[model samples]
Target: MNPTHDWSTTPVTTNLVRGAADLEQTPHGVLPHRLPAWARAQNTDGQLAMVESQPSGVRLAFRTGATTVELDVLPTKRDYVGAPPRPDGVYELLVDGRPARRATATGGNTLTIDMLAGTAETTPGPADTLRFEGLPDRVKDIEIWLPHNETTELGALRTDAPVEPVPGPGRKVWLHHGSSISHGSDAAGPTTTWPALAASRGGVDLVNLGLGGSALLDPFTARTMRDTPADLISVKLGINIVNSDLMRLRAFTPAVHGFLDTIREGHPTAPLLVVSSILCPIHEDTPGPCAPDFSEVSSGRILFRAMGDPAERAAGKLTLNVIREELARIVIQRAARDPHLFYLDGRELYGEADFAKLPLPDQLHPDAAAHHRIGERFAELAFGPGGPLAP
Candidate 1:
């Protein structure tokens, strides 16, 4: 605490959080989760656990007259073995739907992960404080969107003025799940992620489960969606599966069915849009287990290449093309029985033509501009009138 500063301390409660489907109170503090405790317990995979707790779409929304606000957070920052040190996760502050400030929290614990070696080490550090000042000092809606990639434990919140939770606009909640592309990888900022942008344009609240490197058709993830409250839901499948080479078509088809079955258990009638993978030229027609191309790493670049044999497609090895075809078939078959179910070809969002204009820098994840394009396209296709998620 700064003795020179004067502000009233207010404990941030779950009531102030929006976009997180679940919250767990830990000894350190309250941790918001896109996945519930039960779902988290089901998977021992450290990768899935890390990303699910990153608060991808979580934000604190409230109305305040305060000119100054500070939030204390204990962040779990990640470091890779050979890659450049990642920037401290970004916190975006919006005042009355306009970007007011952007900040990064320092002094947090670091987790070193060696993906190739399959190892991780955690080192304890101090909590970081994010401060926002120079507001208009008038009652207005303020939203502080959390970092999309850091696992944050919420701590004390301080404001010079009293705070109240912002009332919802009574819009439907849109729950979405996908791979790193959907997780805002290489995107400009947290709230500017494609899903967040789409949610904003659609006038709906978003709960994003875009787990980077871990969207492996996990049953627990489907069950999490099954339990979460959502008026509209979408699952973006295929890319992660292809990259990991997790399963072939024989297994992939049933996995998709089982995942949808689990979700339908809770949201049978909700507009469940099944979205296929967007174009990744490296794996569009080629099969993968995608491999890191470290040749550019020394030059401060991170790139990926498909490692699987293209000829293996005949053996039913999964590729983006195969998965797209399978997903469309499944959705078409299911739609015959489930009227609310719909299918969206991800290519429609980011396809051959768009790629020509805005290429994926990493040959996998889209850059910030591509995210904007995808978000805008998705908003029109899925959230526009007469669209699957249309009100």
Candidate 2:
């Protein structure tokens, strides 16, 4: 706290939060989660719990006359055993719908992860400060978007002037779910994820459920989306399942059906888009359980390779191609009865043409530029005029 400053502290509350579906009160502060308590209760996986709590699309919005604002947050940062150091999460500020400034908070808990061993350890630490100064001296709507990949416990908000929750802009909410790529993997920052970008370009509120390594068409996730209020919905499927070798083609179709079934229970009339997997050349025809190719780790490079035998495709093992075909077929069949349902070939967002120009740097997730490209394309295809999700 600055001795020269007089600030009013606001308690972290749901009324000030945008883009998150739920908030959990913690000992130090309130932690936002993309999934609600009931949905979280259904899944006991530590990974799922961690990713959902990362607050991928969450932000704080308020109106204030203060020229200076500060936020105190305890961030749970991740560390990898053999990989390069992960970049610090970015906190972006928007004033009156335009980017104002960005800041990064240091001094928080650390979670060390060993990818090969599938182990993790956490060390607690103290909260850090994020301060923004010298804003225009006028009442204005301001938003602070939290880091999409880091789990943050918001401690307090302080502004030199009194602040109040910004009234909802009344934009249609778009709830989305997918794998890491959709979860902002390799994207520049929290607000730069493809979904975030698409939401911005489309002028829609977002509830991103792009759980990294956890988007396996889980029924519980579907139920979460079903219960959340949204005018539009999309579910990107395939990569995680294929890479994990979690199921064969025989099980994939039924799982997709069941996932959609759960969502339709609550949102039968909402426009639901079923999207396939983006192009990953390594997994195009080859099957997966993708494994890390850490041979270049010494050079500060991390890559992945499909470990599943391609020959297993004959045994009904799933691949990107197989999943795409199955998804298209399923959507067509279901659309006959459910006219609100639509199918989007994931390749339409990132396909052969995209790879020729901007490739997936790690044989998997897109780089930051690719994230922008995908976000632009999605906005055009899904939210553009005459598109399936268009108003």
Candidate 3:
């Protein structure tokens, strides 16, 4: 598919993932828009089926002259009825910021860009993993873009470093969990997710558990994070839960404790950071997706695009402020005993001032530039020298 050439001049290195990288953005049961714009975009309606699974894209070009690079571009978010109905064309395989080749995305979320020596379209067998056979030494970095789906969770990094004891119990694995914002929504590509970008800068490894709508104090998810191996851990909570109105105040507090408790089981002494939701005026106080008449709608529907009025929140809903205050209270109580425990407000990463400078498109997710800003803050606060994530 030929991508729509929008030479309107954009940033060269955009944050592929919106806020965090550990978060996985799965379409799940969302409707696929065969709606017109779907034609111009790649994976306009694609999803990764399993939890914490690896999805691969095409490699654009490969060279061995002290460098080898591979990447494929796809669109993570799409609008059909409102925006133009043109499908996002095809995925463009780029090498060092240049369009080197093109990839036809198939299987909804599968597109391969191969540039090993000569050119070949390496396709996934769908039965096994999508592998990039041979990579040259000094590959420096791997960058990805999107015309297809951009919600990518890297399963493994096939390196020649041989499993030789990964050095000092590994580079202090940083485990993070959050919403789709953390799941690389509306970002550029996989490796460029905020978590991945921040990790690269901090020089650490990451295990992300960012689920779209499921981060709302789900025991199963917390169990998954608890069971997963890690050296350090963090949870960016509140936004999705409040927006979705998953649980009540009484339920949320214990759930938060339970979630942290579960994680502590595995990473007993690891540096654990608890992050509250960022600026979201709409559901910052509202507890749920309800009706205009102040009662629960029989329909289990959510107006993600709707702005939660002050009245709505006053009616007894969960807001970011409410969650953050509670989270702070929890962290203070926990930190008194657990020295490794820490709390960082998400807004400290992106606050009201930043909002004025760079407004969010839909008042929820920040754009690529904002992702970079947020990542920088996270890196400085959480992973910089003398920071909590440092060795």
lDDT of all predictions, in order shown? 0.89, 0.91, 0.53
In candidate 1, where is summed lDDT lowest over 10 consecutive residues? 1-10
Alpha carbon deviation, residue 178, candidate 3 (Å): 0.5
Give per-model TM-scores: 0.95, 0.97, 0.63
Backbone clashes counted, model 2: 0
Write the residue-wise lDDT of candidate 3 on 83-195 in tens digits.
Answer: 22223324443344344444333333433322122222323322112223233343333333333233232222222322111113236667778776776554555445577
Best to worst by TM-score, what's the order?
Answer: 2, 1, 3
What TM-score does candidate 1 reach? 0.95
Q: Higher TM-score: candidate 1 or 2?
A: 2
Candidate number achieving the greatest TM-score relative to the actual structure? 2
Off by over 4 Å in 2: 1-6
- Which of 2 and 3 is ahead in lDDT? 2
lDDT by residue for model 2 over 130-203, one digit each (tens)?
99998888889999999999999999898888889888757898999999999999899888899999999999
Give the distance in Å from residue 261's predicted Cα in candidate 1 to where it truly belongs. Answer: 1.7
Residue pairs in collision within model 1: none
